[model samples]
Target chain A: MNGVHDLGGMHGMGPIDPEANEPVFHNEWERRVFAVTIATFGGGNYHVDQFRHAIERMGAANYLSTSYYEHWLHMVETLMIETGAISRDELNAEQTKLAKEAS
Target chain B: MAVLTADMVAGLASTGASCRLDETVAPKFSVGDHVVVRNINPTGHTRLPRYVRGKRGIVDRDHGVFIFPDTNAHSEGEKPQHVYSVRFTPRELWGGDASERDSVYIDMWDDYIDPAS
Candidate 1:
C-alpha cells in the first residue's frame, strides 16, 4: 500500500537528525507498549509483515504525528481486534475504566 | 494456541525470529545481470519501495531464499524465493541531478523484479 510511511526521495520533510544519547524508549507508556506488542506477537496473532501493514494502515495525519512505539501500539490494537482476541467494545470499556481510575 | 510463558520471554527477546528459509531455490537473475523493478501497486502489503518501481538496476548479490512478505502478510503462503541486492545508480532512480558516484542497494524478492528488456 502506498502510504506516508513509504517516504523515500520526497523532499522538504527536513534533514534526518539523530537524537543525542537516544534512549531505547522515551516514555514509560512506550516501554509497556513495546512489551505488550512483543508478547502479543509471540501469540502468533500476526507476522512481522502484517504487523507492519497495520502500522502503514494508520491515517496519514496520525502516522506522521505519532511516535515510533505509538505505531507499535496501533498495530497491536488493530491486530488484536482483527484476530478476535479482543473487541472494540471491550477495548473501549477498558480505556474508559482506566480513564475513570486515573481521574 | 501457543501461550507465551514467563520463562520463554528472555529467550524469545534475545533471539528474534528470522524469515530466512533453508529451502534451496533457483535464482532468476545472476550477479551482474540487469533487471527492472516491477511496477506493482497492490493494495495489500508489499516490501517493494515506490522509488525503485520500474527502475533499472543490476543484481549485485543473491541473499538466498527467504519468505516473500507480499504473500506472507496476507496468510497467502510463504512463497520462499531468492532475494537479490540490486544496485541502482542514483541517476537511474532520482534523475540526472543525482550524484553518479552514489548508488542505492535495495533487497528485492523474485516477484518484485524481472529481466531487463
Candidate 2:
C-alpha cells in the first residue's frame, strides 16, 4: 500500500508526515477492530445493490473528495447509532467529554 | 429506567447479514477493461468512497466475487452487488506527476463497469 507521503504532486498536494504513529486508543484489540473495518470499507469502488441504478445520481464533489477510512468511520458511526449500539445523545456526550478533556 | 432486553439486543445484532469471504466465484471483469466506480451518496448512509466516483479504473485483478449488501446504508433493505478487483494507475487517476508505477487496487461492484473500448 502507498503511504500517504507517496502522494506528493499527484493531486498537486504536498507530502504528508511519513511517521508511523500509534492508534488513538490504548487497546490493541480496538485498534485491530478499527483496522479491520478500514481494510474492507476503506478503499475502492463500492455500491448498494437496490440503489445500483442510481449511482450516477451522486454529486461530483462528494464523489471525489472523501477519504477511505473517513467513509468507513462514517458508515460505522451511522450503523452504531441507528442500531442503538450507541445513541445520538451518548455519542454527542462522549465526544463533548473527550473534547473537553483534551483541552 | 428499564434494562435492555435480550430481544432488543438481538434485534440490533440482526440488523443484517455481513459480507463473507468467498474463494470460488469468478470476477466479471479483467485487467485493462475501462470501468467506473459507482458514486453513491445517501443522506442516510453508503460505503462507496467519495473520491472514486466517476474516475475510471482498469481491472487489475479478479479478487473473485463475494456477496456485498445492496446498501448497508439502507438497513438491509436491498440486495447485494457482485464485487470485483479494479486498479487505477496513479497517472490515470491523478494526472501527470503521479508516480508511473503507483496503482491503487479497489474492489468494485459489477454494475460500476461498462465497456471502455
Candidate 3:
C-alpha cells in the first residue's frame, strides 16, 4: 500500500509552508467533519489502519487538491458505504437535500 | 492514581490482541545479523514502510513478539511474530552520496525480512 500518502523520506516535495496565524480549524464545517468522522470510526465501522488505507486509496490528483479535512470527509463517506452504514445513493440524495436546504 | 469509572472508558481500548510478550520467543536472528527487508507491494494494510522495502540492514535488537499489523488490519488474525529493530544505513537505501552519519531503524516482522546473502 505504497500510496502517495507515504511521502516519508522522498525528495522534491519542496519545503513545508507553516501558515501564519492559522486557527485550530479553518471552519465550523471542518470541526464537525472531524468530530463525526472520529465518532463513526470509534464505533468500529473500520479499523484505524483500514481508515488510513482508505484515505491512501485516493488518486494522486484528488489527494493533492483536497485539504486535510476533505480527505477525512471523503473517507467517512467511503467507510459508511463500505460498512453498509449508508448507501451511495442515500448519501448522495442526502447531500442534495442539504444543499437545497442550505440555499 | 485516582480510580476511573467504567463510563470513562466506554467503547475505548476495546480491541486488538495485546502485542507484548511475557516470555521470550525464539528469535530467527540475533543482534548484528545482516538482513534485507523483502520487497513486497501489498494491496492491503501493512506496517512495513515503503522506504525500507528490499533494502539491507543489520539487526539491532529483538523487540520480541507483536501482533502482525499486516494481518490484523484485514482481520485475518493477529499472527503475532518476532519483530526486530533493523538499522539501515542511508547509503544502502538511497544509493550514493547520501548521509554517512545517518541511518534508519525500522521494527520489522519475521515475514518481512531475510538473511542478507
- TM-scores of the models, in the given order? 0.96, 0.46, 0.81
DockQ computed for model 2 against the true two-chain complex using alpha carbons: 0.08
Could you give candidate 3's per-residue lDDT for residues B12-110 as a string of tens digits? 547532456565567788899999899999977777788889899999999888777788767798776799899988898888898857988889999
- Give the C-alpha lDDT of model 3: 0.81
* Docking quality band of candidate 2, CAPRI definitions: incorrect
**Model 3 bad stretches (over 4 Å):** A20-22, B1-26
**lDDT per residue (tens digit) for residues A1-103 in model 3:** 7777877677888889999998999899999998777667655577676677778887778997899999999889887898787899998899999999999
Computed on alpha carbons, the lDDT of every model, listed in order, comes to 0.92, 0.53, 0.81
User: What would the per-residue lDDT of candidate 2 be over residues B1-117, giving only the tens digit for each residue?
Assistant: 234344555553455334645445555677667887655544533344555666778776655455544344344533444566778777766776986688877777675566554
lDDT of 3 at B27: 75
Question: What digit string (tens of lDDT, one per residue) describes model 1 on residues A1-103?
Answer: 9888888888878878999999998889999998898888886777899999999999889999998998999999999999998999999999999999999
Candidate numbers, best DockQ first, in rank order: 1, 3, 2
> TM-score of the candidate numbered 2?
0.46
Cα displacement (angstroms), candidate 1, residue B103, comes to 1.0
